[model samples]
Target: MFSGAQLSLYPMSDDFVGIITGALSALDPHRDHLRIETDDLSTLIVGPPEILFSAMRDLFVAAARSGTHCVLSATVSRGCPGEPDDPICTPAEGTLPVAPLDERIAKAVAAVKAAPETGQPVACQVSLYPLGVNQHMDEIEGCIAFLKASGVFDRPKNFCTKLSGDAGAVFATLQQAFTRFGAAASHVALDVTVSAHSPTRA
Candidate 1:
């Protein structure tokens, strides 16, 4: 089992460099916890699913706090061949051979909940890709219904769902969505772009 992601960040402003640097700086503290490599195009992070998602949450939130429009694009994968055969990429007994999406989501939600509050709501946009699953649309629709009923989902935007609320509640909803869908689907991949401090933030 191996889990990793290639992430690219784009800050839609003239001060893009500053925003990018800020996000990288935030991730610096977690370097000891992950295997990270940065190139001109993207940053590759490899580690346990929980740690990867936690680091991503912190990096994205720090960038969002810059008060600029920022987008983080990531292609996440697991069980890749030729990856380092280390504990970080190894699965424990009784868990999926690939990265466990449910656990990853729980860890990500915890990270979001632990983030410092700014007296304003935070928002995140997410798209879930459940690969090799039958009746995928039905599962997606069910997840959407759960998100809406949870009251954290703001709306559906183009290819993703917008979630806004107190950070804890919003993240909890995310955890629920991932857990439910992941359990029903064979393989789940998520593409997420979050704005911790939305333009509407007070």
Candidate 2:
């Protein structure tokens, strides 16, 4: 399966360049495990879901630690037929096909519960797209059910669902929702925006 994410970081500060550059170092440990490329627009990370989410979490946390409001926008996808499979995207261990919706929802909830806290709190909105599947709505609904039970779920938004909590559980929830839905080899994508240290938060 081919899995990857294209993400951009925005730090609301005059020294945004410094903050972004310094925060990128958080991904250093994951460099060997992922194929990372950065241009003017966004950074593309290709690898297994575990390394992908962890790297994202670390990078976002590093930037947020600077005490500046930061937002991370990411489009994560897996099993897209348009993209060719790369050896680097292979997981260390193979995965089975997606299970029944109820089973998947249960497992996703369990995974989020087990996520370690990062102390850094984040608010995020996400919309999942399960493409090329006949029962896409079923998968989407199942994901929504899982999110509502994820403990981090904040509420439902206009076109997405809102989640707020420690960055750890939030990201874990996103990862689970992305992986547990749709067919194993089918295309699945997640549109996500995560904010930390926002001024408007009470």
Candidate 3:
């Protein structure tokens, strides 16, 4: 199963357009469904749990960083399951969809804000990399042991295989998550999801 957060951004700016689009493109592939529609501000993306999950916990900071307000009042659309028809034509960027950092950070922040408080559980799953290919899994395991031993793993959990915290807590969590892992966690050739919540308006 998969999940994500849906967001309606307000007062969208031109600069944010590219950033939001890029982040959306980076994370959209993991979704069973996705969308970006024009709004009075700029655009709104419905990031289902499967698409972003709690990994987007940093959205609040991202929005502030982008200097935009992400409205919480949203209207969500259910996704129709099944593979999308292949486009008749292709572009230079190819078949992958895209969005910007403004949207990306907003999506993450909203996801965290909408996360269940207390009783709800979130996880941070880390993938260890050796900075170069051809490293053995055993070496990777050792590195993980050392990192965990550093006492970082004992922190509160959020999302699935990703960070989860209150709106104020996620920015730093995401920083570490992104740094040790590839910025996009591509070294693992996988996407980070921030699910474990129901839905939100923003």
| Each candidate: RMSD | 5.1, 1.1, 14.8
Best by TM-score: 2
Per-prediction TM-score to the true structure, in the order listed = 0.68, 0.97, 0.27
Worst 10 residues of 2 by lDDT: 90-99
**What are the per-residue Cα lDDT tens digits for candidate 1 across 109-142?**
5544564443435677878776676767866776
How many residue pairs in model 1 have overlapping backbones? 0
Of the two candidates 1 and 3, the one with more favorable TM-score, higher being better, is 1
Q: Runs in model 2 with CA error above 4 Å? A: none
Q: What lDDT score belongs to each candidate, Candidate 1 first? A: 0.64, 0.92, 0.34
lDDT tens digits by residue: candidate 3, 73-167: 22222221222322321212332222333343344344334434333233334343323335445444433333343322433234223344443
Query: What is the C-alpha lDDT profile of model 2 across 84-159, one tens digit per residue?
Result: 9887777655773457888889888998999999899999999999999999999899999999999999999899
Residues forming the 10-long window of minimal summed lDDT in candidate 3: 71-80
Ranking by TM-score: 2, 1, 3
By lDDT, the better pick of 2 and 3 is 2
